[model samples]
Target: MTTTASYEQLKLLKQFIDESKTIIFYGGAGTSTESGIPDYRSKHGVWTAMTRDGFDPVKYANPQFIKKYPEKFFAKNEERDNRPVPEPNATHKILANWEQSGKDVRIITQNVDGLHQKAGHRYVLELHGHHRLWHCMSCQREYLSEEVKRDEDNIPRCFVCEGIVRPNVVYFGENASKDTVGKARRSMKAADLLIIAGTSLTTPLAKRLIYDFEGDKIVVINLNEVNISPLKADLFIQDWVGEVMTTLSEMN
Candidate 1:
């Protein structure tokens, strides 16, 4: 069951949302769990691949892995492509709503799934790049999701140059795009309120970003431990993101 913070904390969060003009949202895989996407380090998350599937993503989805086992790398991505496509759930919807309501809301997400864009959010910075898009290494031509999926061998190639196409997602040993990083930092610096949800803040990047926030209010919503100290958050809501967002929407 998802846990909820005390009434006082909820009240404080509501007030923060009401008062803040600029809000920055930083989300992780947990943000999409309600949409059927598994998180990376959770109990049954993708990181469990070692025990569950006999191959960890670190070994299968890395740049070195792609160099050594191209077929296996594409096959793994093919499996991911075959999984049910997930739609944005309550959390995504609420955030989108805030954007539509003329709130200066910007999202910085670690998820590669384009759920935020699908949810009608316009200004989203994808820290992990995109999952449904790919580019040919030789020609740099982009391929749509369908075009990439049409390959029988699972290894997509450029139609124009026959160059190997690779997913835009960040593999192990890769850093996020410099452009994305700069924008995220600028957004956080400009935000009057920082809303972090569905992340454990385990990654160095996540910790650094949150710790650098100069926002007036910092709200953390999560079902699991976020690694951030409770003292750092103006309001810490321990709950499913979907549940919390739905309740907040209703309260508005």
Candidate 2:
């Protein structure tokens, strides 16, 4: 059931890309790492474990907990806001060009960095939301990231209502956005070639989106193996994202 040789597999992938009018890219943390973004779940990532008030810090900042002790919620999450900025890398640039070329139809990503949009891909589904927003729960107000620096507080409170402000990215306990999920499904359904790249697919929500792809060719591109063997995947390449994308970009 497999191709005769590795050469055939790569050729098939490039051929599929050439043929498909609709392409959907489902990406993960590794997608943005070339841009200097820290993948918080990766081995090299910085954020991990801590405990506060006898609860796992991750759990304590969820919407439910934020509704309760917002001061601590904002306190715990300020790090995400203060994270160093990352710009678009080769992988992101190649995809952006693909979008402009009308080959790439949409991007569905688990990253909150907004790198895809930054690289000039206009249509993106951010399953985890974006870090560019600073949101205030009390006033239901939102501000750009730069605006927060001027505010004289560590865990900034809303000037209107003194409610806690947190970055807008999705947390562990929250459901994936229904709009993102539904749109992702439709994109996958319409795609002739679906590329699952720069993703371990280990985390929540992303694996589900991969399952939604019933396209002609399913490709998994990552630097390492993943836990679930993709049922529909026709090819798996353990290569760094930018290297592979730069290769793929030349197949035009």
Number of the top TM-score candidate: 1
lDDT of 2 by residue, 26-45 (tens): 88887888777766556676
Scored by lDDT, the top model is 1
What C-alpha lDDT values do all the predictions have? 0.82, 0.74
lDDT of 2 at 107: 89
With a 3 Å backbone cut-off (N, CA, C), the pairs that clash in candidate 1 are none
Candidate 1 ranges with C-alpha deviation above 4 Å: 1-3, 149-151, 229-231
Candidate 1's residue-wise lDDT over 119-172, tens digit each?
A: 999999998899678888678888876677335766777888777788888878
What TM-score would each prediction reach against the true structure? Answer: 0.92, 0.83
* Model 1 TM-score on a 0 to 1 scale: 0.92
Clashes of each: 0, 0
